[model samples]
Target: MRIYQFLHNAFLFAASRMQAAGLEGRKEEQRLWIQVNAYRDFIMATGQVYLFEDYLAGVAPTSRPHVSTALGARPDTTSQRVMALLLKAFDETPEPEQKQSVSLLIHQVNFIADTGQLEACEDYIHNRLDYAPLAIAHFTTREEAEAWLMGPAEPPSPADILIGDEYYTAVYSREDNVRFMSRDYVIEPYIEELAAEGIPPTAPAFETRAEAEECLKSHPASPFDFVSIAGEHYLAVHHKRLNRHTLHPVASTLTQWEEQKRVVEREEARYAAMNTEGEDEES
Candidate 1:
C-alpha cells in the first residue's frame, strides 16, 4: 500500500516538472532526455502493479533483478529530474494519453513530496499544453516507510514463559514439606482393591512401605499401587485426609460426562414439575 502511494506521488511530481519545463521553453539536453525516455519505457513496460501485495503474501518476484533496479535507480534530484525523465520517455512512444497520464502523475508527486520543482513543471505544462496542474496538499512522510526501511527494536515472543523466584520457592516448599508415605498407609491392601476394580498394573514397584505410600499419596488412584502390592512392596497414602469420602466416582470413562449430568438434571427438573402440578390439582 505504501509503495503504491509513493509511486503515485512520484509520478505526479514528474508531471509537474514536465509542465514547468514546457512553459519555460527549457528543452532538456538531448542525451539526458534520451536516457529519461528509456528509463520511463522500462518502468511502464515491466513495473509490477501489485509488488507490495505479492511481497506480503510471501510470493517471490518473477524478476528479482528488476526489483533491485527500480529501488536502486531512484533519482536523488528534485521533481524536475523526475519529470524530465517521464517526458523524454513519453516522447519516444508519442502516446498522447500516456503523456497526459505522466503529466498528471508528476503533479501528484510534487504535491506529496512538497518539492518546489513541481511549480516550475506545472507552469511549463500549462503554458505549453493549456492544461492546468491539479492543486494538491503537500505529502507528509509516512511512519510505515521509515519503519520498513529501518527496522524497529525487537519485541519478546508471546510463548516465552519466565518462572520467577516466588513460583520456584512455592513449588520447592510444597515438595519438601510432604512427609514420607510408608509411615502412614498400607500399600498391599490398596493395590488389591484397585485390581478388584479392574485397574491395570505396572512393574518396577516401590521398594519400601514408605516409598509405596509416597507413590500412592502422589497419585492416589494410579494402577501402579496394584503392581506394588502384588510385588510385596510397601505402600502409603497421605494421612492428612485419608478418611474423607466423596460420593462422586473417582474417575469416569465416559467422554460426554457433562452432557450426561445435564440430562440427569433435566429429568429431575421435569419430575419436579410433574409433582408440583399433581399437588396443585389435589389442593
Candidate 2:
C-alpha cells in the first residue's frame, strides 16, 4: 500500500510541473504579442513624421513661408524635440524587434544628415522610422485624420446596380442570372461621373480603376461595379461596348453585395447548427 501511495504522489507532482510549464509558456507568448503590437504602433506613428516633412518641403519651395516655417518657429528648437517625448516612451519599453527598427532609423537619419539632402531627412523619418508628426499636428480630430488619410466618405451605392469595368452597368435588372467575371474590375469612368454629380474628386468612391482592380483580384469573387462589392465567385464577363472585361471579378454595388453576403452567412450558420444537432443526437 505504501509503494502504491508513493507512485501516485510522484505522478501528481509530475502533472503539476507540466501544468506550470504550460502556464509559463502561455504567459511568455502573451508578453511577446504585447511587445510586437507596441512595436508596430510605434513604427507606424514614427513613419508619419517623414510624410509630413515631405509635404512641408513640397509647399516650402513654392509657398512664401512654407508650413515647416511654422514648425521651425515653434519653441521646439529641433525636429528631434517634437519627437523626443514619443521616442522616450518607446525607449522605456521597447520590444526586441522595435529596438532593431529604431536602430535602423538612427543610422538612416545620420546618413541623410551627412548627405545634406533636406528631402532625405523626411524619407528617413517617414519610411525608415514610420513617424508622421505632421499628420498628427494638422488633423486634430479622427474625422479630419480619416479624410486626410483615405479621402472623404461619399453616399452609399444604390441597390440592384452592377458596375461595369468602365461605368455603372444596371445589373439589378438581371438579378438572378447576372454573372461576374472577376472581383478586381473597376470603372474609372464611374468615378468621374460621381465627381460630376457633385462628389469631390477626393471622395472615397473615386478610386483609381487600376488600384481597384488590383484590390478586387486579391479577393475570391468579382466585386459589384456600382459600390465595388465583391461577389462570391469571380466571373469575368466581356463587354464589347466598354472595350472589354480586361480583368476578372469586376467591382459591384456595395448594397446588393452586402445582402448577398448576409444570405451566404445565414446559410452557413444554418448548416453548422444542423451538423451540431446531428452530433448531439449521435452522442
The most accurate candidate by TM-score is 2
Instruction: Estimate the lDDT of model 1.
Output: 0.35
lDDT score, candidate 1, position 277: 100
lDDT scores for all predictions? 0.35, 0.34
- The per-prediction tally of clashing pairs is 30, 38
lDDT of 1 by residue, 1-283 (tens): 4434544554554455556666677666433333333332222222222332233345232311111222223455434455555445555535555554554343333232332333343333334223111111111233332232234432111111112100001010112332111111122233345435664445336555456445555465322323344354222222221221111121321223445557879999999999999999999
Cα RMSD for candidates in order: 30.4, 22.1
Model 2 TM = 0.20
* Worst ten in a row by lDDT for model 2: 166-175
Question: Per-residue lDDT for 1-283 in model 2, tens only?
Answer: 2322332343343344335546778653333223322322332333322332233234322211112233333353233342342244236534554443333333223223333433433443344322211111222344443343333322111111233222221111112333222122133333333324542223223145555456445542222233222222223333321223333232343444556568879999999999999999999
On a 0 to 100 scale, what is the lDDT of residue 132 in model 2?
A: 14
Per-residue lDDT, model 1, residue 161, is 12
Task: Estimate TM-scores for all models.
Answer: 0.18, 0.20
Candidate 2 Cα misplacement greater than 4 A, ranges: 1-82, 101-258, 263-283
Best by lDDT: 1
